[model samples]
Structures are given as structure tokens and as C-alpha cells.
Target: MTFAFPRAVLEQHTAFLGKTGSGKTSTAKLAVEQILAANPAARVCVLDPIKSDWWGMTSSADGQRPGLPFYILGGPRGHVALHDSAGKAIGELVATGDLPLSIIDMADFNAGGLQKFFNDFAPALMKRMRGVVYLVIEEAHEFAPKERAGIGAENLAIHNAKKLATAGRSKGIRLMVVTQRTQALHNAVLGSCDTMIAHRLTAPADQDPVKKWLKSNVDKMTFERVSSSLASLKTGSGWLCSGEAQVADLVQFPKISTFDNSATPTDGDAELHVQTAPVDRDRLRAIIGDAVKLAEENDVPRLRAEIIRLNAELASSGASQTVAAPQEEIDAAYQEGLWTGCIPSWTCSRT
Candidate 1:
């Protein structure tokens, strides 16, 4: 089962909400793998607050090409361990200031001398790569709660996460927030996300916020239907709601058996199944028409690229944006007669 999200919105960020054992981590892992497969240049950082699901899902380094580098951010002696990146000691990550103290204290992970390490090491690591960085945070609510959070040290992880959400886009950083308590999550995180994978949510408060988030007139009945679907969803099925697309989808992941001895799930496995209404033809045509119009106008790669990007977004979510193409660009296209250029080429010419 292949599940493709709108790349445009997906580039910004994403959030996954579900109960434990609801396959949130598995879904997240599959998403990461998919992104990596698309772009091998993708760099990722996984912060497992409890150090389980995300940590163990990496390939080992062989005598040949090195495997992906995996690091554990919080734990005793709390130093970073190099799995695929050999020749690197665990002391370096511990010696760096990148580790948040708040995450340290909350997890009860004793880093010993590494306490001073992160304060001095974080800035350096922040400067390393310029490629796409996927930051995965599991049990996110503990780090960024709206109320009764721990003082300074325990809040560092949450604070850093928010900071990343606000500015990471420009820096080529993408965040994937996975949590069971969607009701307690911070809006800053959700607001920053372009795609949201909603699993089983039983909270009314949590259910209400999404309606407001999408600014959609989703009635109470639709909300309940969406929520109820999540509760009974199979391992790889859930609802995908985004600024650009909202669909009941089943994401089929790859099978894990194809890979080496790695614990990561193999490719060719279905991630989830989405059960929802059929595609609305009229709406899809309108969206396609708008995209064609944009392509005809301007004729610039950047501008046309943006239109295609938006079209994909709308296609995934089944939602349209209120922001339309600027009037000046449209007028210029018409004046230059560029508007008709793409139309004839696109028509089927069928009998």
C-alpha cells in the first residue's frame, strides 16, 4: 500500500496523533523511510524520549558504505553513541551542548559530566549539514505541554522543538511530532505542520481543535464519524488531514523482510487504510483548472512550480486555499496570450 502525501505541505512539517499501540511510531518510521528513499540526501534526527521504538530502527554499518547515523539524545552517561558513523566516540555527542537538559532531567537520564557538554556542543551540531533534516519527537506532550510543565531543564526540549518549528523550514528542517495525548499538545507545533495524520482520538477537546484548525465547516456529525473511524482503524489505516488534503487513507508501507538484519519494518507493507467519501469531481476539476491557469501565466519556473506544488497539496487534502493567484500575474498572462498555451496541449482531443 503506497501512501503519498502532498510534498509541498509535507515539506513544512507533520504531526501524528494516536493511542499507544495504535501504530503511530510505525507510521512515522515508514514516512521517514519513504522520504529517505525519495531523497538520499535526507538527514534525520530521532529523539526517543523513552528510547525504544525510534532508536532500534536503524541499519548497521558494514565494511562497505557506512549506514545512517543514529543517536540517542537522553539516557545515563547520556553521551551520544555512533552506530553507523564509526571512528566517532560516544564522548563527542556527550561533550556537545546539543542535548537539552530538560529532556535529561525528565527522562531521569544521568549524563554525569555530559551536563556541561550539551550547553557547549549544541551550536556546533546545529551548523553541520545543509540538507533536509527529519526531526522525530515521540511522546511529544511531555516536552511541550500548555500547562504544569517542569521548570528550566525539563522544558528545554519543548522550547527547542517550538523554535525549530518556527524557523526550521528555511533551514531545511522538517519535524514529525508523534504523541498519544493530542489534547494536551501545543498549538505552535500543530500550526506549523502542513500535514497531520490523525489516528484514534477520543477527546472532544482534541476533536474540536481540528475543525478550528482547518477553518472548515465540518459539522459535528462529520467530526464524530472521523473520530470513530480512528478508534477502530487497523494497524496501517487512519485519516490524513492537511491544509491541502483531507482523506480517509490506508498507507501501505514497505515490507521489512527485504532489508538486512535491521529491525526496521520491510518495504511492501500497508501502513494504514483510510475509509472515507469518494473524490469530488467538480472540486478536482476546479483545482486542476486553477493550476493550468497558473502554468499559463508568468511562465516562470518558480511561479509554475508553486502552482504545481499547490495543486498537489489540494489534491491530497481535498481542500482549496483561499489565497488565489495574484490578479497582476493573471492579467499579464492573458495580455501576453500565454493563458491559451497550455490548454490545447492538455485537452484529450477524444472523440
Candidate 2:
């Protein structure tokens, strides 16, 4: 059965919670496809905290056709390098620019770096957005954890998440909070969601949020029926409960249009090999140049700035030649930072 998403469901804040191999991400991707199909001009931004399969959005389900041209920022497969400091700038860019699908793939970052990025990003994106924007926060629990270590960044992150839950609707921010561990996430954030699509959640703790949701939205008998079935729901199937959509149904998601790069390989499967769809190199490079500028010190921005300065100088001198910055300069800057051990902000800022 094909699960349909109403605009009421899409525009309002929603939570997608499930255990591993339960097809939560794929279900979210189905929503994305539906949204984009409904409004091709809709702005969508995905923040994948790890080396996730969101890159599959660039390829068709068959891995043969060109899918959406989502500009990826940082990862082993990213076009632009990502840094913790870049969070503030990236968030603003997503809000202010007319860019295409933007995916912030922070696979290279550690736990401390993730906290720093979320600290800077959540507030910036929340404040800068003026139009209707759809933002997907994968691994939402990590950014808005129930247990924080009393770190300022972690506190700020949860603060911004709570604000996003409470105030983001009036500001035209459509959010999807996706996580495997719903109990680990902030209650206020999950509770604030108008809709919750929960797949198979086996653990009692993990099923707590859905239980709370069901109890509040449905009759006692209905809630009991749904709660009992939480652990045995089929893969790709979920209970779509939403007050706004007026939906409470067991739905099955259809096949996604994009490649499923996140699928686990079985023991008998051959070594995985994939070839993503094609893109315009020149155009993509131009877009990546803008994303590259989001990075701060000891990064590509300074080097690019120096190259621009040299190009302007050449132009003023009536010279037709322009040159890129030397490799030695970038190498020297990186080496200096490495030796000094100075990037303290991203290393967790406890003091």
C-alpha cells in the first residue's frame, strides 16, 4: 500500500521514530519524494550526522538515472569540506539562499564536533529563516539528548531544539525529527510534533514516546491495541498518527525513487559496488565554491580569498592571467594548526 502524506502532515513538525532495520529513513525519504513532487520549488535541507546514505538522493532507485541534484557538504563523498565552525554559516546559507537540495553530511566529525556544530547551527537556522523551509534532522537524539554532560554547547543545542518545537511553526519552519532512540530524545521536542510515524520499536523505553502519543490522541482501547502491536510491525510499515491530518492508520510505504544506499548487505551478498548518477561538473563546482566559503580559518575560504585577491590584482594591472593559491600555503596553514593544537572550540569547550 502507498502511504500518502497530506500537506498538513508535511508542513507541521513530525517525528519518525523506529529501531534499526525498521525502514524509518526510507519512510522519511518517501515523504521527501512526495513533498518534492507536490512542489518542486520547495526548499529541503537534510542534516545527516554520520556517513549516512542520504547521498543516495543523487541517484535513482535503479542506480541508473539522475536523481535530485542535492548539493552535499562534507563526507567521504562530499563536494565541499565540512568543519565544526562552518555550522553557523551553512545554516544561514540554507535559510537565505535559493540553493537546491542541501545535505550537510558530517561523517568526518566526532561527538564533540557534532555538539559544537549543532550549537552554532540550530540557532542560526532558526533565526535566519524567513520563508517556508523543510529541515530534516537525522539522529535528532544526538543533538537534543535527554542526558547532557552540562556542556554549554549541548545545553544550547537542546534549548534551540525546544524552541524549534515550540516556536518554529509560526516562523514557517517545517521540521522532521528522525531517530532510532526516541526515549533518548527530548520529550518536549517529540511531544510537540503534530504527527508521529513510529515503526517497530521493541524496547519498552524506546516505545515510551509513542505510548505517550497514543495515550493522548486515541481512546484507551485504541491506545492499548496500538501499543501492543508496536514491537511486531512489519518493515516499511508504521502507524501514521496525526491530529492535524486526522489520520490514524497502519500504512505501508512504497518503493522510493532514490537509491537505497543505507540498506545493510547480507552475508551472502557480493562486495558492494555503486555508481551514482551523473551531474553537471561545472555547475556543481560553482555551487560547491559557495559552500566552501562557509568554512572558517585554516580552511578553503582563506585560500580562495587569497586567490581572488591575486586575480583582482592581475585585472587591475591589465594582465589576462590568473592563478590559484599555492599548495604550500594551504599545507603550511594546516601544519601550523595541527602543531599548535589550537582548535579548542570544537574539541568540547567544557571550561
Top candidate (lDDT) = 2
lDDT of 1: 0.50
The lDDT per prediction is 0.50, 0.77
Model 2 bad stretches (over 4 Å) = 149-152, 264-351
Q: Candidate 2's error at 151, in angstroms?
A: 6.3
Looking at candidate 1, the ten consecutive residues that score lowest on lDDT are 82-91
Task: Report the lDDT tens digits of candidate 2 across residue range 18-93.
Answer: 9988988898888988888888888889989875658888777876666777777777667667776677777777
lDDT of 2 at 241: 86
RMSD to true structure for each model, in Å: 25.6, 7.9
How close is every model to the real structure, measured as TM-score?
0.54, 0.80
> Over the full model, what C-alpha lDDT does candidate 2 score relative to the true structure?
0.77
